[model samples]
Target: MLVYSFQGFSQERPLQQSKELPQRTDAPTNSQQPNNPNQDNNEKGRKTLEPRPISEYKIISVKNDTTHVDTALTIVKDYEFNYLRKDDLHLLPFTNVGQTYVTLSHTFNTTSLMPLFGARARHFNYYEVEDINYYHVPTPVTELYFRTVFEQGQNLEAFFTTNISPQVNIFIGYKGLRSLGKYQHILTSTGNFQVGFSVDTKNDRYHVKTHFTAQDLLNQENGGLSPQGVINYLGDDEEFDDRSALDVNFEDAENILDGRRFYLNQSYDIIKKNDSIQNNQITLGHVIDFTDKEYRYEQSSANEIFGEAFETTNLRDEVEFQEVNNQLSLTFSNAVLGRIGGLIGHADYNYGYQRVLIQESGTIPNRLIGDVFYTGATYNNTIGKLAIDGLAKINVSGDFDGNHIQGAISYPLSIGSISASVSTNSRRPNYNFLLYQSDYVEYNWFNDFDNVQTQRLAFDFKSKKYVDASLTFTTINNYTYFAANGIEVDQEGFENPVTFNIAKPTQYDEQVNYLKLKASKTFEYGVLGSSSDLIYQNVSSDDEVLNVPDIVVRSSLYYKDHWFDKALYLQTGFTAKYFTSYNGDGYDPILAEFYTQNQQEIEGFPIVDFFFNAKIKTARIYFKVENIPSLLFGNDNFVAPAQPFRDDVIRFGLQWNYFL
Candidate 1:
C-alpha cells in the first residue's frame, strides 16, 4: 500500500496562442483574388498609391499538446467466493481485483493520427467451503462442514497502437496470465485435496487475434471408508439413511482428482474492406478449443484402530473425458443503391466431440455435436427521412433450433429535442439449454448449472431526450426457469414412507415480463454541480429462480467540489431487492429428499455504500465503506451454514504515477 499527503496544491494552467486555428479547406486558394474583378471593385492585383496600406492577415497556428485526460491509477484488492453466491463461480485474482489503467495519447503532424499505450496489475486471495450440506446422502451435512480453497493469480498486458486513418489502425500487444489453486475437504473422515494450474497467452493485431491456454489439475483423497470395506461407526439412526451411509463409506474410494488441459486459437481478418462507392465488406473468423481430463480415486479405512484386525475395503477407479470443438464464421455485406443500407448475411458452423471413460470398468460414453447458423438483415439510415433498422437470425444445432427477427424505426422530433423508438425481438435457446443431464459430472465434481427453457419473444419501447429522462418497457415470453429440486420424506417407521412433493425443478413454459425506468438530472448549485440517477426493474418469473429477485431498484447521488480546493468528491448509493415465490407443477425427484414441506419465503434486503475521493497532480486517494448497516439475511438453498450476512468494511488507498 502507498500513501500520499499534499498541501497548497495549485492547478496547472493551459498555455494559449495568439493566433487562431487555420480554416479547414479541401484545397488551398488565393482568397484575396476575386473571381469577378468588377463585382469586387477592389482593383485586384493593381498596385495603388501607398502600397495598399499593407493589410495584415495572420493565419494563426499553434502546436497541439497531448492532454492526459482522465488517466487513472489505483491499487484494489478483495476476497470474494463468488459473484451472486453461486457454487460454480471460479475464483480468480490479480487482474480481477478492480485494477485501474493509466493511458497516455500523443499526436504528431496531425492527419487525425494518434497513438496510445497502457498497462495494469492487480491481485487478491479467495477461499470457499463446498459439499457441507450433502455427501453420501446426495449432499453434505451441515455438521460435516470443512474448509477447502487456495487461489493465486496474476495477469499483465501492455499495448501500443497508432491510427493511420480514422477507423483504421495497426496495433501490437502482449498478454500473459497464470492461476494456481488448491482445495481441501473431508468426507467420511477422509481428506480430499485438489490442486491446479493454468496459463494463457494472447496476441492481437489489426483485424486478427490469436490465443492459447493450458491447465493441469490434480486431486487426491485418503483415509475414507470404502464400499465393501470395514466400518466402525455410523451417524444417528434418525436423519441417516442406509443408502447414504453406504455412500459415505464409499466416498473416499470413489474420490478421484483428475488433471485437465485446454488449448484455443482464433483469428479474424477482413476479406474485403468497404469502399466509398459500394460500401462492401467481408470478414471471416475461425476458432478451436480442446480439453483432456483424467481422474483417479482410492478408498481406505481405519480397521485396526482398536487392536482387532478387521476387513479392508479397497476400491480403485479412474475416469477420463476428452473434448474438441471447432467453429468458423463468414460475413458479407453490401450497400444498396448507394443510399439505404443493402444486404448483410452470415453463416456459422461448429462441431464438437466428447468422450468419457470409466477406467475400472473399461466403460466409455461418447457424444458428437454439430451446429449451424445462417442470418441476414437489412438497414436504411435514411428511408424518406425515416431511419430504419432490422435484424434476423436462423440457428440449427444439436441443442438449439429457432429463428429470431427484430425491427425498429426512429426519427428526430421537435428540432432534435426528443426521439423515440420501438422494437420487437425473439430469441431461441442457448447451446446448453437443449441438453438436459442431471447426472453429468464436470471437473470430477457433480455440481450442475443448467437452464430449463429458452426465450421466445420480446418487445421493447425506448424514449430519450438528450439527458433528462429515459424509459424502457419490455414484454418477454417463453422465459427459462432453473428450479432446484425440492423434496420431502418421512423419517419415521420403515414401511410405506409418505412423500410430499414440493416444487418440481423444471423449465415451466411461462411468460416473463419486466419494465425499466431511469431518470437523471444535473444541477449546478452548491459546490460546482451534482448529478443523480435512479433506476428500477420489475421482474416476474413462472418459477422461483433460486435466489434471484423479482424487483430491484438502484439509486446513486454525488457531491463534488465541496472541499480541498475542488479536489474532494463524495458518492453514495443504495440497492433494494424484492422476491417472489416459485410457481411450478410438482416436486423434482432430485430435490424431494433434501427439503421440508414448509418452505420459508426469503425477505427483501437493502444494501448501501459510500465512497470519497481526492485528486492531486500526481496522486489520487479514495476511501470506501460497504454494507453500512450490516444486515444479516437467511437462506436455506445454499450449502453453507449461513447465508452471506451483512458485510461491513472500510478501505482507504492512494495511488501515484510518473513517467520516465
Candidate 2:
C-alpha cells in the first residue's frame, strides 16, 4: 500500500536470529490427545499465538535470504492478481502488459546462479520454478486457494504448515495450473510440489533447514497465428464473433519440462553466545544442493506447422541438465555492529553435466567443475542499515568464463529512502546456445559464440506516504540474441509456413544500452483511494530489436466500506492501463524463443478491469471482469505481434485460511 523510506523508519530493528517461540496456551498437554478424539470439536476453546509484531514475519523468497525476517517498513507490493493474470508468461507485479518477448525484460537481470539448460519460453517461468515461503505459527495452519477465469484454465493451491515441536516445524505445499488459453492449440499444464522442514536444538546452538522441490510443466505450442491468419484480425475484418473461432499455426507441437531439486542447510554454533539482544557468537554452516532438469520438444505432424519439405521429419529434441553443489560458511556478530549486524564468509564447489539428444543423434554428454568464494557484511542502526557482498568463481577443469561481481547499498532519508545496486557478469553461452541439432530446417545450429558480458546500475527511492521511483540502466557487450532475420529459403515470406529459422545474434561491437524509469503514487480520500503508475523506457538500438513502449500508464480508483453491521467488508475498484505503440517480438515455437519483429505496431489501446473484493471474517473473495472494452468494441490490442490479448473474461477467486 505504501513505499518505505529509511528516514521515516522509527521502530528499532529486532535482534537478528532471535531464539523465541510463542507458547501454546490453549492446547491441553499431549497426554490428552489420546483420550480426546474430539478434534472435530471447535468446542472447547484453546489458546493460540497472539499476533506477533510485523517485524517477526518471515518469507523465504528467492530474492532475499531465507532466514531474514520481514518488517512493516520493508517495501510492500500490490497484489499480483490485479491484472487478472497470475504466474504466466513474462509478467511481474506493478508493471507488465503481456508483451510476448523471450526475455522477462529488455533490461538487465541477475542470471541464475545454478547450471541451466535454457528452455524457458514453453513454461512461462511458472511451472518450471519454485518459491519457498515460511510462516511461524503455534498451531497447525492450512491455506487453500482456487481460481478459474475462462475456458479450461484452473489455478489451485494447497499449503499446510505445523510445528512438530517448539524447536521443529514442517510444511508441504502443492500448486497445479492448467490453462487452455484463449487462442487455439495453446494449452499449458503444470504441477509443482514441495516439502520442507526447519529444526533447532533446545539451546538454539544447532539448526538445520531442508527441502525437496519438484516441477513438471507441459505446453502445447501453436507458434502464434500464421502470418496470413494474423492479418485477418488486425482490422475490422469480421473474422469471427467469438475468440475461439480463431485459427492456429501448430496443432501437434508439445513441449515438456521436468525438474527436481534436493537441498539441505545445517549449521552449528562453535563459540559462546551472549544473552543480550546483540551477540558475540561463531556459527559454521554447510550447504548441499543437487538439481536435475530435462526439457523435451515433440511434434508428431511437423508438416502441419513446418511443411515436411526441406527434408524435415517428425521433430523431437530432448536435453537434460544435472548439477551438484557443496558450500560451507562461517558467520560472526557482535553488539558493536549497530541495530542490524552480521558478517559471513563462504566457499562453494560445483559439478555440472549436460546431455543432448537430437533426431537419431543419440546422446551427447558434457561436464564441468567449478568453485566460488563469497564474503558479505551487514551493519544497521536506528538511522539506517547497509549490506555488501562480493563473489568470485572459476571452473577447475572447464572454464572460468562465468564470473561476476555484485554490490548494493541503501540509506533512508527524512521523507523517503534510496538504494543503489550494480552487477557485472561475464559468462560463456549456455549449452543449448553453443550446440543444437535437429531435423527441422531452422532448428539446427552449431556456432562458436563469444563470451557475454552485461553490466547494470540501478537506483531507487521510496516515500512512506506519497510516491516511489526507480531507475535502471544496462549495457550489454557481445550480447547473444536469438535473431529472427535469417531462415531457410522456403520459409521466407511464406503464408502460414510452419518452420522458421531465426538467425542468432552472436557477436556485436556496439553495446546494447537500455534505460528504464518507474514511478508510482497513491492518493487517499475519505472513502476513496487512487493509485497511479508511470513507466518510461529507451534503448540505444533501433526499435527493431528490443521493442519497448515509450510510455506506460496504469491507474486505479477504489472505494472501501463495511456493511451488515461491519461484519462484511468490501473493496470495489476499476483499473485502466495504456501502453504506447511499438513493434514487439514475435515468438517462434520450434526454437522456444522470441525473435525480433518489425511487423505490426500494437499500442494506443486501453485495457480496463472492474473488480470487487469482499472479506467475511477470515475468508476473502474477489470477482473481476477483464478487458470489457475490447470485447465490446475496437480490436487490435494484440499482446504480441499477431497474438491478441485475452478476450473478455469473468474471473472469481477465493482464499480461505485456517489455524487449528
Candidate 3:
C-alpha cells in the first residue's frame, strides 16, 4: 500500500515514546475466524477488504505521520500514565513515555546523551500508519484499556485482531505502564508490545506488511529530594505523612531500557495494468523494506552523587545497541499528478548496520562497528483540499553523517486542519559522541565537534468546532548540550551544595533561537463543555544551553448527561495546568543524561483536576482527583530538575471493546 509511501514515511524521524490514542479503534480478537487480504487470486478463494469508508476509519502513525492532535482536547488523559508528568498527556511536551529527546527535532543527531538507551528512542523497527479498514469483518476485533491512579499508578492498553483467511490479517498489541512514586525512591515501569500481519497478493499487484516489537523501560533514580529531604518530604507537618518517608539522593539508583523490533513491508506493482492512467487512475510501485533492531541499557545500583557519575563503586551500568535496515523503493501515483488531487511519490535507498556495546566500570570491553548509506525521497500532494509533504535524508558513512530535509502543508477546512512545515538539519557525531569509554570522570570523551545545524519553522491550526493553533520557529548551530563549569561549594560558599551535580558534553558557539505559541479552544452549551489551552515559549540560548517552560496553560470544564435510560453516558470535568519559570535539566542516573542545570528555577506551578467520565455498553470510564487543590494548595510540583510529579492522587480507568 505505497498508498503514497503512506504519506511520506511518517515524517521521517525524531521523537518517540510519548503517546496516546483510544477514543475507539476497533481491534478485538478472542480468536474469531474468516477475513481477507493476501489473495492475488489463489484460485478465487480469498479477496477481501473493500467496503471501508467510515470516512476511512483512521489510526495513522504506525510510526510516522508526525502525529499531532492534542493541544489539549482532553480524552482519556489521566496524565497519560505519567512518565514524569509535564502534562500535554499523550506526550511530546518535555518528553518521556519511554524517554528519548533532542528536544524539538529536525532529525540528524548523535550528540547522544543516551536518550534512555539511544538509537534515538528505541527504534528497532515496526511502524504502522494506514487507517480506516474493514475489508471483511463479521466477527473478531478487540480493545481493552485500563487506568488507575494513586493505587500506585497504572495505564494499560490491549488489542486483538482477526481474519486468518480471505487472504490475511492478524493482530495483537499492548501498552503498559507503572508508577509507584510519591517521592522518595520514585519508580516507573514501561512495556510495549506488538504483533502483526497484513497481506494481499493474488494479482491485485502485491502488498505485504509484518511487525513484531517489544519494549521495556524502567527508571528509579531519586538523586534529587534531600536538601533536608525537601523540607522532610513535602512537610506541612503531620510528620510528612510518610511520603515514602522522604530521603533520596541515590539510594542505589536504577535505570533500565530494553527493546526489540522486526519488520517487513512489501509492495510491488509496476504499471502496465492496461496503462493510460487506467482510464485516468495512475499508479506504479516497487518497495522492499526490512528491519531488525535492539537497544539496551541497564543500571542496577551505583551512585556517588553526580560528580563521578559511575565508574565503579561496585559497577553496574551497561549499554547495548544494534540496528539493521534495508529499504529500496520507487513509487508513484496520480489522480491528476500535479495540479489538483491525488499524487504520491517516493524514491529511496537506505541500508544500514550499526552496533555498539560498552560495559562500564573503567572502560574497555567495547564493540563498535558501523556502516551506512542513504538516499531519500517522499512527496504527497493534493491541491483541492490542500495537502503537501516532502522529506529527504542523506548519509554515506558512519552514524549519521549529514543532510536532512522536511516540508509539510495541510489544508482541509470546514471543521479542521491547517498545517505547515520546514526543516534543515546537518549532522555528524554520535558514536557515543565520537568515542566514549566511561571510567566515569564525566564518562570519558574525545571531542572535535562541529557540524550540527538546524533551522525550523512551523504553523498549525485545527478546529472541529472552536479552535486550535500553533506557531514555532527554531534555529541552532553547533549547540550540543550536557554542560557544566563544575561547582560544588558548601558551607556558606553556596553553589551546588545540596545534592551535588556536575556535567559534561558541551558544544555551543552562538546562534540559538526558538519561539513557540499555541492555543486551543472548545465550548459547547446545552450539555455543557469547555476547554482551553495556551502556550508560549521563547529561548535564545536559554540560561546557557536551553531548557523549556515559558508559559503553558490548560483548562477544562464539562458536564454531560444520559443515565439509566441511556444505559449510561455521563461526564464531569475540571482540569487545570499552568506553567512558567525555568531551570531545566538535572537528571543523571549515572549518566542517563539531562545534566546542565543553573542554580535552580523551576517556578510557577498549578495543577487541578476532577473528572468522572463514563460510557457503558462497551466500557469507557475514567475518574479523577489529581491535586484537587492538593487538599487546598499544598504545593510540591516539579516536572524535571528533581522530578516530583505525582502527589495528591485518586485516579480511575477502564476501557472495553469486543466486536464478537
Candidate that scores best on TM-score: 2
Query: How would you encode candidate 1's per-residue C-alpha lDDT over 1-660 as one tens digit per residue?
Result: 011111111111123211211211212345774454223225453322211111111111111112221223111111111221121111111111221111110001111000000000010111111110100110000111111122343333332222222222222323233322221122211112222111112222233222222222222222223222112112323322222232211123223223232333233435444465637655454545444433334445422211111224553334344444454545454454322222222222221124343535344333324333433344435555566655544444334344555455666555343344444433433222222221212111111223222222222233333345545555545543323332233333335443323222233456555555555544544544344444444555654432223333333344545356634333322322222332212212111111212243434444455656554443445566645654232111211111112234454544332210
- TM-scores, all candidates, are 0.45, 0.79, 0.30
> Per-residue lDDT for 187 in model 3?
62
Go through the candidates in order and give each one's C-alpha lDDT.
0.30, 0.59, 0.55
lDDT of 1: 0.30
Worst 10-residue stretch by lDDT in candidate 1? Answer: 112-121
lDDT per residue, candidate 3, 283-329, as tens digits?
A: 33333323233333344444445445544554454555554555565
For residue 204, model 2's alpha carbon misses the true position, in angstroms, by 1.9
Which residue pairs in candidate 2 collide?
7-413, 26-47, 305-498, 306-498, 339-380, 340-380
TM-score of candidate 2 relative to the true fold: 0.79
Ranking 1 against 3 by TM-score, winner: 1
TM-score of 3: 0.30
Q: Which ten residues in a row have the lowest lDDT in candidate 3?
A: 107-116
lDDT of 2 by residue, 317-381 (tens): 76666666666666665555432223232323232234343445444334344444433333333
* Ranking of predictions according to TM-score: 2, 1, 3
Model 2 has an lDDT value of 0.59
